[model samples]
Target: MKPPCYLIVLAFLPSFSFCEIVVKGDGILQDTSLTKNEATPTKPQASKPDPAGDDLILFDNGDVMHGTFGGIQGGLLWERKDIDRPIKFSIPAIRQVVFKGSSGVVMEKETSFITLVSGDRIPGKIVSLDDKSLVVKSSVVGDLKIPREHIKSLSPNPFDGELFYSGPYNSNGWMILDYRKTKEKDKAKEIAGEEKKPKKEVIQENGKVKEESSAWIHSGASFYSLDNRALVYPDANMPDIGRLKFKAKWKGRLNLTLALHSDFTRVLPAEKKEEPKAEEAEEIEDGEKPKAEGEQKPRKKEQPEKQDPAPLQKERLVDFRKNNAFQNIAWINPSKRTHADMFGTGYTMTLYSSYPNLSRNYFSETGVARTQRMASVRSNISLSEGGDAEIEIRYNRKESLMILFINGTYAAQWNDLGGFPGDGTGFGIVNNTSNARVRISEVMITSWNGMTDSANSMIHPDRDLVLLGNGTDRFSGQVIEIKDGVALLKSAYMNAEIPVKDLSKIVLKKSTSTDLDSDDLSEDLTWAKEPMTIIYKPFGKIRLNPISAERNLLSGNSPFFGEITVDLSSAAMLRFTEGSPDLSDWFDDL
Candidate 1:
């Protein structure tokens, strides 16, 4: 078989296809039936793989190949776009390979120039280079500045070794150099032209940053870091730049006072070097310039410094145990209170007199008058011996319980007093058969104790106590006390205080009455004179006129005239005495 001639012509064209490579002396394309001579195929060159240090450049295609260096000292490697293999390069051949990303500019040929991603490029002699940034200087574009982070890789510029003066020893780190030796023609003026003039000073004080002594500004208010590269300060939003004045002090340890504002030019007392003299002030006023102070003095401007508000006052606590005992007594009495009075407006002062020897024959002239609801009678017994005895009388009311207690014991109960025997002045002992001398001590008249409501804690307004007596010769030296359903008394003469309980046997007795009037029809005595009219404060006298002459019989002869009916609701204290209606004349009225 013979080889095809068309396949032979396509091998040597380097720009035609990407996959196939051509070989001239090798018998790869010869006849299949014939064997080529292994010796001397036109003195064939060695096509061994390229060394790793040899420059190889890669294109966008999936081709792999070896290519020759392109620049002055083989500093660059290039390959045709129609190659069938990846192109490679020596690491040293790269001067400055800047990757400007998709639409960025590439370096044109062999100029010391590199274009930026924005297609702006300038040629320069590289002065310094590092991963972070780069410095370059050349005659074409004097002092070209670039960031090394923008460059993909770099080879050290040979000219920068000696004149750049790499400083000091370093570990595996980058080194800095002095780029001062590199000079350009009239470079100073060009540098001045590229620099900006001093406009205004903006300083940060307290929490605010201010400029032009006008307003405060924040970082993003008028300036922004564009992709962390350049600071973009828009003209419309450019901050007013100036200086500021400040004042400060220490309120206490760990606390500070800071106030900052405009007007920073005036010299302050803290920074003053010396006092001004009168002669120097006059000389300066004569138009000579003042000599310079050693350093600038900062003025202290007045401001509202931070301060704490006034602290609150707390209430004081007190202990209650140390006070006096009298302060704890709740002292109160009924007579001193004028608000709710049961007694009438005026009191009958003469009604407390004692009376004696009452008689019914004198009833017309006396104050004793009969009434259906009340009457009074008294039984007189003669005493042969002056000895002590009790007068036990029981006059019971059918509608209500009536008890007369003496000295804490029940004395008598009146269960039938509602039916008076004749509305008459009678002389009868409510109780019978007595031998001891008698005297009336105290009396308490009340409604049924059990029938009244317990909730009414106060004494019933309808209930009260009364006491009536004769002269000192008859019924003297008596004491009376009343509270709750009880009464107490001590009699004169014998003066013994007795405990009287129960109302069943109220007895008035004589110390010596030898013979009893047993079964005698007329033995019970009738009252010969009217009884004394006992005027009371709480209860009205029902059967008598208070101003009449019946009160004078307290020492008279009749039995009924000396009798006294105590309406317990009326006079709490009652004294009936034999006198000219004058209490001082009754000896026992006291």
Candidate 2:
């Protein structure tokens, strides 16, 4: 493969660069002349208009144009019907832009509500804070100043279904790694060495007695073999994480091994013991020394006894050897009830942790295995010193790495792991401490690299963007059609028709790109021959001036997966106009 002739990365853009570039009701706009699709992480190929309604492009000079969108090039919005002479509108002159679909983020306008002890709820952001009082910025009223003691709690605005799960504990799908009899059995395995040993037998080969090598006897520990109820996800339908592989079926399972927590595995410290009182007096300064008989010196206060680290059980097992770095597998496999997950099938690196130091222990599961093959890297920055902290573990399967961030601090990165079993394969967490607890506030499984983050920090990127806010979460894409309040949202991930009621907001963003003309921009146009309405049977209807389809499945892209076959099922139905051609008969035409 040859490198490109020019590779340019734009760090900054001119002021109001995207003002003129307009995104019509439809999110599809192919800008060929400016930056090519090869500019960055693969440019988006906008789908042609699917006839939602009469789309109006509102301008600053109080001008409105109603027509189907052809494409946007050189910061000009093109209006096309039969494509005679495409009407081009400058992107800058555009003022108000309205979309026909769901915003996909804010279903309804929401705000954080602060409930007062007086039973009054103020909806807004906690803008200012002080020891004595705080202020809340609300839309209905101006800044509300209330005593800190008067406020009860702040109720978070209800989010869409996008929040997977959050809280102090998820006891549903997690399994505890308990080692009771396994502890004794594990020690015996280390002594005798063997997951299982077949009865010894002698065989005669060529009239001579021969013996089999005893190497088959394994000297490793294993987990109790139970139909690991804890090795899977709590929910059946979760986003698949596309990072970390080398084994199959490693889905939705996190390395929660409670044994990983020190509070459960290490020994606790001895309690502080009171010091005995002194019976004899001591000398003070040379001149002030006590010389009187029966005179005693003042007793100093004894410092409180310091406590030691909490006690924890030693249940984790690892066999670190070569690239066969799965010493954990070696120990886990020996257990009578321990069932190794599919991810346990190959080489794995194993690293130990040290809480006294702030660092991550990196290991390869397949490098090697032995009693003590590899050493674990422990971080001096102790999570042990404080209470529960926020931890986010993300794996980018494309890079085959596991990254850990504690309290938004990058703690560790495990790149030794291989690729992911599948994209969006999620993971879970396991608690090891007996009394201590950790809570999860929320989890977001996203494909795009934080381009349109709505929660925590609502950073909306200015674009011809439409957010299809699903009940669970949302993805940004082009709005294909809006009929009867149901909008067909098209993106590279998945395609679906969502009721406009479920939408957060469908916004046509302001553009700042310079107006440059492209000659071949028309080549990407899809000219519709007959006007048709896509009867999205159950929900609503969509009109497509020129509709396109294939023999069986609808030729389209999925908002979740690229280039997916849209199964013509209960949700998908079609109707046509008076002069519309019979699609059944036009199967050959397809």
Candidate 3:
């Protein structure tokens, strides 16, 4: 095939430049973009009004945008919709704003309290937040329990300065800015103590204005210092009233606050054990002889325990395999339960987590190939034939399970050994083959890569773009390699690989990184219409091969294999699941 030529494209490859851009909101734009029919929900695509656009606007928080309507306004993109209802929020709430670098969108609302895209509702006061989670407090909900990844946006009610008891035991009173230093407050107290006569202001018609005492807690990014501050215990009896003082900083080195003095007894070391030791070590002189390695045994490094990477929720794939004896007859029931399954005389088979090479010969109602063969290996569960088959696989933080359905009826069950060689530990599926006629019409897998809801939306790129490592959206890119069951994307600036199952939605967007005229830019993904080639080089070495169901798997009636080679590199991959296989079975049992 001739390499089609076009003018030089603005290659924003490997340059993961940090920039913020504007996302403009044109009033009442016709929203014709179709919702991607993904098992998992995804972020909506923006309709490109005109391409050839230049001058990307970066937001205050370092987000960049480039489409027809893109720009930052007041810490958020102006392009977002204002969903601030009168009762929900007096402060304006932006509905939907696209995050920079990828197609993720952030949604905001008010009075809805706190509901994450994942469906967890956190009802309480939001004390603090970051990109991934938030800390909230409520008597009913107790404390911070929601992660930011689950949230779409935060909606804070407008402060009315009215003290209301929102919690079971505490009242969120009016926030008065008490800027007076400790000395100034002390002087006021001394003066109040020196009063000789009954104070007219303190006494009302029936009673005196009582002084309110409570701890002011801030959970912002700054580190807090609790120096000699005493927390009053419920059981402790205090003499009339007493006070405690301490300081805390947000995202800083030290905390500050005045010491507390009270008759109520609650005593301990002022600082935590680790914090003081760290401080003490820093104060040691440079010339002073350090303790011998054995004398003062060095503290063992507390390595951040490696978290088992998130699990990949996979579905089954039933295609043709060369080594399998049942090439003509798709195993109506393959004993290997975890990976792929077949039934309906090979006409209708279900694929669970991964796609496999398949042939249409088995799909025909009747033929010389209408003969079934035993599975290449035995699966923990046996598969039975008759009627259309469906494979259901579920994934969680740890493992994945597979279930088989015949003619939409329950048939078989299996636990994926997890990785190849049945370690039951790895993610993704490969190194196996199946032959069936049915087109893999359905594939459902749980994912963490991208999620969507009223509050948050994430993008799960198709196989090609995800391998780019940088996670930037490119208009024209191709699949170059499948290493260790992972697909690698090749482009001028980007060279990265991703798990094949990670491909949920592939989007084609107008490249807005460099300066170009609006007339030259096209919003639709015209390039994607051409066939994408997945080059396979021994699943380890870089190679190119057109990954077409027809080309490599079958030519008319005969099976053929071809090979091409290429150079490739690396990219980090993140997998997440929406549901667990165990949960699916348990729910089914109920």
Q: What TM-score would each prediction reach against the true structure?
A: 0.12, 0.25, 0.17
Per-candidate local distance difference test: 0.23, 0.32, 0.24
- Model 3 scores a TM of 0.17
Which numbered prediction scores highest in TM-score against the true structure?
A: 2
Comparing 2 and 3 on TM-score, the stronger one: 2
| lDDT, model 3, position 242 | 15
Candidate 1 ranges with C-alpha deviation above 4 Å: 1-54, 57-62, 69-135, 138-143, 147-590
Model 1 clash tally, residue pairs:
76
Candidate 3, run of 10 with poorest lDDT: 568-577
Find the number of clashing residue pairs for candidate 3.
Answer: 63
Query: Per-residue lDDT of 287-397 in model 1, one digit per residue for the tens?
Result: 845557785555678888888643432211111112211011111122222100111111100000121121111111122222121122322232222222222122222
Decreasing lDDT order of the candidates: 2, 3, 1
Regions of candidate 3 where Cα sits further than 4 Å from its true position: 1-31, 34-76, 79-361, 364-590
> Between candidates 2 and 3, which one is better according to lDDT?
2
Top candidate by lDDT: 2
In lDDT terms, how accurate is model 2?
0.32
